[model samples]
Target: MLLAIDTATQAVTVAVHDGATVVAEHSTSDARRHTELLAPSIRDTLRAAGLRPRDLSAIAVGVGPGPFTGLRVGVVTARTMGLALGVPVHGVCSLDALAHGVMADGERTRFLVATDARRKEVYWAAYDVTDQGVRRSDGPDVARAADLPAHLRGLPTAGRGPLLYPDALPHALPQLDVGAGALATFAMGALRRGEELLEPQPLYLRRPDAVPQSERKPVSTA
Candidate 1:
């Protein structure tokens, strides 16, 4: 069994996949409580599925292009559990997981998967989903929604970022809002296939929302 966790966005998703088939899954959109809620949810999902931590073959985590706090919460939890349970922890790109969620079986098409990155920018990726599964075609980049390239205009798109930023959506392709379950499913497939797992790291494509100390101005007295 493969246990997967995704706290890459506001949503917190957990799933138990027995190879390609998902035996159980749970998720909720609680941006403020990911730290407090994730562990209990994981326990409940596994208990509901009649499994234990040691029963899992591996653990998968969404190494994110997400906000720092929530992204770290998921990765840290996964790492801690992997260490305690002696299971290998695998990392999956958050955008790849979102694309997997949107893809329909046997439909070969290009797509863009996006997630909100606040400050009016988005974490985005382009993909092609064929019978073999989703393949990354373009970046997992951080870009302003209004600056989306012309080539991406004709492809199908999904995720909260695009839905939230409708002005960026072109008329040529369909758009859908997919979530974390798809991510968990996709990550499970990668783990089962013996894919090389990347080191867990936050995909912060741009600078964080903080000013440098040197850039700060000092207060003056009259």
Candidate 2:
């Protein structure tokens, strides 16, 4: 069994996966309530799946290109759970989850995966959907919505970024949210194949909004 969690964007998703099937899952799209909502949702999902923490063989979490605080909540939970349960923890790109959500629908072979970065910029990547699964071909770059590479302008896009910058990407797709199931599925495939999972690290593409006062240079006497 696997426990999956994602709090990388406005969405808060939690799921319990029994092999390829998602046994129980819960999700809510409230950007302001990640901390308050995540633990309860995980508890509810596990209960619905009829499993306990010890039953989880591994934990898969979305390590995101997201706001600092929201992204930290998920990663920290996964790490703490892994320590408590004595199971391995796997980190996955949140963008890959968004891509998988779209690929499941058998959409175009190629498209862009993006998510809101909340500074009038987006965390974007390109994916090539294949029979094996979704493969990332290009960026996981952060750029101003209007400054996206010219080549990516018209391609099919998914995630909240398109919703935020409609004109910049006209061919936006409807499956904007990435479910925790997709995160579990992606991690399971890699584990089954004995492939190395992405390092358990948060992919915060830019420095956080909060900075330490120590990093600031003191005013020099003039």
**Candidate 2 residue-wise lDDT, 6-93, digit = tens:** 9998899998889878889899999999999999999999999999888899999999878899999999999999999999899998
Q: Pick the candidate with the highest lDDT.
A: 2
Worst 10 residues of 2 by lDDT: 100-109
Model 1 segments more than 4 A misplaced: 105-108, 170-180, 210-222
Off by over 4 Å in 2: 214-222
lDDT of 1 by residue, 53-82 (tens): 989878888888887788889899988999
On a 0 to 1 TM-score scale, where does candidate 1 land against the true structure? Answer: 0.86
* 218: Cα error in model 2, Å: 7.1
Q: What is the TM-score of each candidate against the true structure?
A: 0.86, 0.94
**Residue 125 of model 2: what lDDT?**
92
Judged by whole-model lDDT over C-alpha atoms, candidate 1 comes out at: 0.77
Winning model by TM-score:
2
C-alpha RMSD by candidate, in order: 3.2, 2.2
